[model samples]
Structure formats: C-alpha cells, structure tokens
Target: RQHSAQTRWVVLNLTGEAKSWTLPEASGATAVLLTTESTPPTINGNALPLRPNEGVILAI
Candidate 1:
C-alpha cells in the first residue's frame, strides 16, 4: 500500500521453511518497520530472509 509520503510492503513466509525475498525497487531507502520474528530486522542488499510463518512490514 502507498500513502502520501511512503509506500508500505507486507511480506509473509507462509511455508514451513525459511525463505528469501527480493524487495521491490523503491524510490528511496527502505526499512523494516515491523516483523513477527524476534531477531533484529536486517536486509542483505535487497534480499530479506523470512523464517517460517513470519511476516514483515516494510516502508519505503
């Protein structure tokens, strides 16, 4: 979803195993605002790793 100043992306790992996702290109910087997992949020380059049944909210 998009708002006046930022875009929000919701990513989920529905499978039982971990998964990696390449975030969509954004006009500005991106940050992980919220996550289901306890670990600190980190994105490797543009790739995000999600544990099983995890979800995240990204802002750009």
Candidate 2:
C-alpha cells in the first residue's frame, strides 16, 4: 500500500479532560497516534489517544 491515499490524521479534543469516545474506522484498518501527550487515548479497547495539536493517521 505504498503511497496509498488512505491515511488520515484525525484530531480529537477532550477539552482538557479524559473521556471515552468512538470513531468510524474501516474494518481491519490500522491507526497510529501522532500526539505527544503523557496519557495516550484509547481506541476500540486499546490505549491510543490523540493529544492537543496532535493526530492519528487511520488506515482505511
């Protein structure tokens, strides 16, 4: 999947608070957190958070 245009940086804002949320990720797709926050978020039962001014590239 080289140079595939299926990667997207999704930003999530918790308003400086910790919260639980869900996103629409493609089946069997992958996601990478690009944030530098001390506490990483969770996704689909996993700890993958996106801090302020940060993003996660989701493979769809």
Candidate 3:
C-alpha cells in the first residue's frame, strides 16, 4: 500500500512451516516497519524469511 511518500509492503506466512518470500523490486532500500513475531526473520537481499503464521509490514 502506498500513501503520500511512503510505500508499505505486507507479507504473511499462512503455512505451517517457515517460508521465504521474494519481495517486489523497489527503487529504494527496504526495512522492516512492523512484525507480528517476537523475533523477526532476517531479510536476505530481496528475499524475506517468514516463520509460520508470521506477518510483517515493510517500508520501501
């Protein structure tokens, strides 16, 4: 979702096991804005690791 000058990305892992999500190509760097889990998984390049039932909001 985009609003004003900020673009937000929402990622969720609904499966029972860990998963990796490939993020969309962005013009600028991305960062984790919010997460549902206590320990958020690391962002590997454009790929994000997400635990089961985890969700995150990213800023780009």
Candidate number with greatest TM-score: 2
lDDT of 2 by residue, 3-48 (tens): 7757455554533445445666553334543443435656556676
lDDT of each: 0.46, 0.52, 0.46
Which run of 10 residues does model 1 get worst, by summed lDDT? Answer: 12-21
Residue 9 Cα positional deviation in candidate 1, in Å, after optimal superposition: 2.4
Model 1 error, position 30 (Å): 5.1
Q: Candidate 1 — which residues are off by over 4 angstroms?
A: 1-3, 26-60
lDDT of 2: 0.52
The pairs that clash in candidate 1 are none
Query: Which candidate, 1 or 2, would have the higher lDDT against the true structure?
Result: 2
C-alpha RMSD between model 3 and the true structure: 6.5
Model 3, residue pairs in steric clash: none
TM-scores of all predicted structures: 0.29, 0.37, 0.30
Q: Report clash pairs, candidate 2.
A: 41-48, 41-49
